[model samples]
Structure formats: structure tokens, C-alpha cells
Target: MTAISLPSAMEFIWLEADLLDSHDYAAWLALWTATGHYIIPTERDAEDYAAVLNVVYDDQEMREARVKRLQSGLSMSASPAARTVRTVSRFRAMDGAAGVFVVRCAQHIVEYKYDRTRMLAADVLFWLVPAASGISLQRKVVTLINGDDALHGIGYLL
Candidate 1:
């Protein structure tokens, strides 16, 4: 198998961000490994997300269900999903296990809805595993800058 490079990892991350900004859930979902986890912790310093109260902690099945709901236009909060533009940058990579690596980046997202605009920033970590296709996301943890504060009106993916 060919080794993945830092530039390639950055490219893949950018693609994922673009897919999210465009609301292309299907394409975005395909970027994950079968056992991939998508986690958003309410506590900025939480180590084990399963033991803590998280804004989101989804596995493959939950992710699929969420995508279905977001695309179905049935849920009130998601029916008119907030438009978002995300910028992911300041990428730093570190090797994890034998074939896995972690990419850490800063993400700033601007969400617009109901004539109001909100800005959310986070430090995101993506654990990536090598795959035949190059790389796939094994885990994603988003630690919001103000995660301990009350947060609402988020109706779409982060």
C-alpha cells in the first residue's frame, strides 16, 4: 500500500469541509471508515466522550440515520437547514498507531439562518486510517471554543 502524505491528508480534509459546506451529505458520509465515530463534546477537555455529555456522538448507523433525516426534510430544525461556510486550516499531523495518524486543525464556521448570523469556532481532531483508496476517517472529535456554554440553533452537521 502507498503511504499517505501530509498534502494528501490536507486535500482530503478540505474536500470533506467543502462537502459539508455544500450540504452534500451523501458524499460526505462516504469519506468515513465503517467504524468511524463523529463526536462533538460539550466539555472542551473531555477525554472519553462516551462517558460524558456530548453534543453529538454518532457511529455509522447513527450517522446514516441523521443523514436520512437531514435529507428527508421532516425534522423541524432541519427542514430549513442553516446555511454554513466552514474554514478548516492550521493543520498539524502526528502519527498514531502503526498505520494511523491524527490531523489537528482549527475550524471556523459561519452559520446563517432566520436573518441572523452566528460564528462557531472549534479545534478539530481527525483520526485517519490508511485504506486501499488512500485514507478514511476513523474518528472525528470537535471541541468547540465555547463548548461549556449553552449552545443552540445548530441544525446541521459540524
Candidate 2:
């Protein structure tokens, strides 16, 4: 696997945010590896998600199921289909082993739906691996800035 350059990593990050904002679920799903995990914790200090409850803990299969639900329009929470815009910044690439890297960044995401708009600030950590096409996500950990705070329906992807 070729080492992922800084520019390439940044491009990958941008592409992901764009795809999500565009509601291109199929395209975004293709960016993950077979064993990729997407997690959102309720506790910022929690280490074991299995032992402690998490807001979102999605494996590939779970992710696919979620996409299906959103696309099928059966989810009542997604009735109007929320619109989202995300800005990714403060990206720093950290070495992971020989070829892999861990990217840390801050994401400011705004979601609009149901005649309401909500803003969420989050810190994201992505485990990136080189793939045949480009980079694939091994894991994505999103820590909400207000993790411990009471949140309304967060039905949309953040």
C-alpha cells in the first residue's frame, strides 16, 4: 500500500463531507472497508462502548441497514429528510504503524429539518487505510462536544 500523502488525505476528508452533505449515502458507504466501524459516544470519557451505551455504534451491516431505512423513507424521523452542511478543519495526520494514519479533525455540522435547525460541534477521529481506489475508513469515532448534554432527536447522520 502506498503511503497516503497529506494532500490526498485532505482531499479524502473533503470528499466524505461533501458526499454526506449531498445525501449521497451509497457513495459515502463505499468509502469504508469491510470491517469499518462508525461510533458516536454518549460519554466523552468512555472507553468500552460495548460495556457502556453509545449513541451510535455501527458496523458495515448496521450502516447498510441505516442507509436502507433512510432511502426507503419508512423512518418517521426522516420523514422530511434533514439537510446537512459540514465543515471539517484542524486536520492533523498522525502516524499509525507503517502505512496507516489516524486523522484528527473538528467538524461543525448544521442540520435543518422539521422547521428547525440544529448545530453540532464534534471532534472526529478517522482511522484511514490505503485501498485499491484510494483511502478506506477502518474506523470513525465522533465525539460530540455536548456528549453529556440532553439532545433532541438526532435522527440524521452527523
In terms of lDDT, the best-performing candidate is 1
Predicted candidate 2, C-alpha RMSD: 1.4
Candidate 1 lDDT over 37-71, as tens digits, reads 99999888777889999988999999999999888
Q: Can you list the residue pairs that collide in candidate 2?
A: none
**Whole-model lDDT values for every prediction:** 0.90, 0.87
Off by over 4 Å in 2: none
- Runs of candidate 1 with Cα error greater than 4 angstroms are none
**Model 2 lDDT, residue 102, Cα:** 88
lDDT, candidate 1, equals 0.90
